[model samples]
Target: MRKLVVLLLLFGTIAHSQTQGFAKSSDGTPIFYRTFGSGKPILIINGGPGMNSNGFEALAKKLGEHNLTIIYDQRATGKSKLEKPSEKNISMDLMVDDIEQLRQKLGFDSWIVLGHSFGGMLASYYTSLHPEKVEKLILSSSGGIDLELLNHRDLVQKNLDKTYRDSLAYWDKKIRKGDTTYVTKLGRARALAPAYVVNPKFYAMLAKRLSQSDRALNTLVWLDMNRMHFDCSEKLKTFTKPVLILQGKRDIIPAELAERAHKVLQNSRVVLMENCSHYGWLDAENVYFSEIGNFLKP
Candidate 1:
């Protein structure tokens, strides 16, 4: 049975005042969430097929200018604590259901959705399932449904240092074996950090962020997604709502994918960031947010 879990902070006076806690998912997972700003509602879905959403905190703050932004750690990630960890519990269906439930529980008629990377893929799927629930859709550096088509594993591996690449086989084995140790998780992030960012200076920042995250690399979830290879291009083709596609010119995801997405979603607008990589907001903050502001204007 699903239950709503509310955790109250008793130690710190300031922390207790914040309206943040967990919402128990159907399979009895506690999903942590926080709300920022106040206006039209907008939920920012982060990438990282299994990475925590807390890393987008600063991005959420920047987007709060005209919307009540919502950010949350997906199940088994960040502050979302799970009683029992299993790949079976990490399906895309469950993840999308969690978003719908969160929306209903929060009492929003409908709201804007901005998804980055894997989060963008999830947002697209969510729109396909429940078109009436999404006001606008923003897919940033997200690929289409076919997991194989989105495969940049080669790029990621090539970008890693020789030593890291040599150790990857060992790390992959440990991850597949369900080793949730901090070292294993942090090591994986460090190895892939180079492929995700263009700025070398941000490499340390990325490593530090991953190190601090309540990291849970659910390898099975990734494996299952690739196996199923779901595609929702047909649904997107018929989607009439406003859609925006954002991609970085230097991102490993490839700008062609975003352009293809724009073609599939007829009403979508595409924005390609110059001199930027995967993390456009980090590499070109001002331009990134400015484009978002313009696109959001009525």
Candidate 2:
């Protein structure tokens, strides 16, 4: 009976370690985060600059089997709560500072960082600010800091079908007109779905998740964040650490951007997944996992 009680206590301890919690940033913003598995620590950042960590839950769990995977929602997104959210409070610098503070709060000296889409941009910028703190960097389907150079609007529109494009344009105009409601955001997600996935069903699943999360689509954050002070290409070139750039051929972010990023970085490798969209992990899990596994291997 005593042995059974001891075993239960042990299991409870393990479960508690995997539980979700909030790391308070310097400015008192509560950033929600979770830890999984154990071994080499890896910090995974989600995109949207406003997206919660839920979208990457599957991938994080898979990677967690070997590494200590940590995922967090940025300020004003997901479970993270922010008071009086505004452009001044959520700039790129503050976001990077939040990451640093979170690391300190969690008592991790350094960790591997994997940023997906817009999260990739954040990871890159964060590494630039504190390169010594990041052991390695992974950028998934993320373009450079300057959105204009990537031609996201033109490339995404060109690939999408006419129906999707028209719908996206209409919703975008609505969103710009102060209609950033949940329904309007879901409409935008549905319209942009084609650019992110080859399978319409996957898009449906993503749309459902988007609606469930109820993430507020803030255009100002997207605009001001992308207009960063630093040049990602030039800054990344200075880093001596290794970088892995994962890109999907069919993604809204053009493959050329990843290729260009690879060319600029000193120790970087580019993996262009054929027949995969922005959500490469969903489209080609085997290839994605294999590449990540190989890179993460000691």
What tens-digit string does per-residue lDDT give for candidate 2 at 1-298?
A: 9999999998656643575788888888888898887778899988775668888888888888777899998888877887667777867788888899889988989999998888888898898889899999898998664453435568777768999989999998997899978898889888877777776779987875555443344564665665664466666778888889998878878877787778877889999888888888888778989999999987
lDDT per residue as tens, model 1, 56-164: 8888876875667889888877788665657678788888888987887788999999999888888998998888999899887886544644555565665556976
Angstrom error of the Cα, residue 22, model 1: value is: 2.9
The segments of candidate 1 whose C-alpha lies over 4 angstroms from its true place after superposition are 1-18, 148-151, 158-188, 211-217
Choose the strongest candidate by lDDT. 2
Candidate 2: stretches off by over 4 Å: 1-17, 145-150, 169-181, 210-217, 226-228
lDDT of each: 0.77, 0.80
TM-score for candidate 1: 0.82
**Steric collisions counted per model:** 0, 0
Candidate 2: 10-residue stretch with minimal lDDT: 211-220
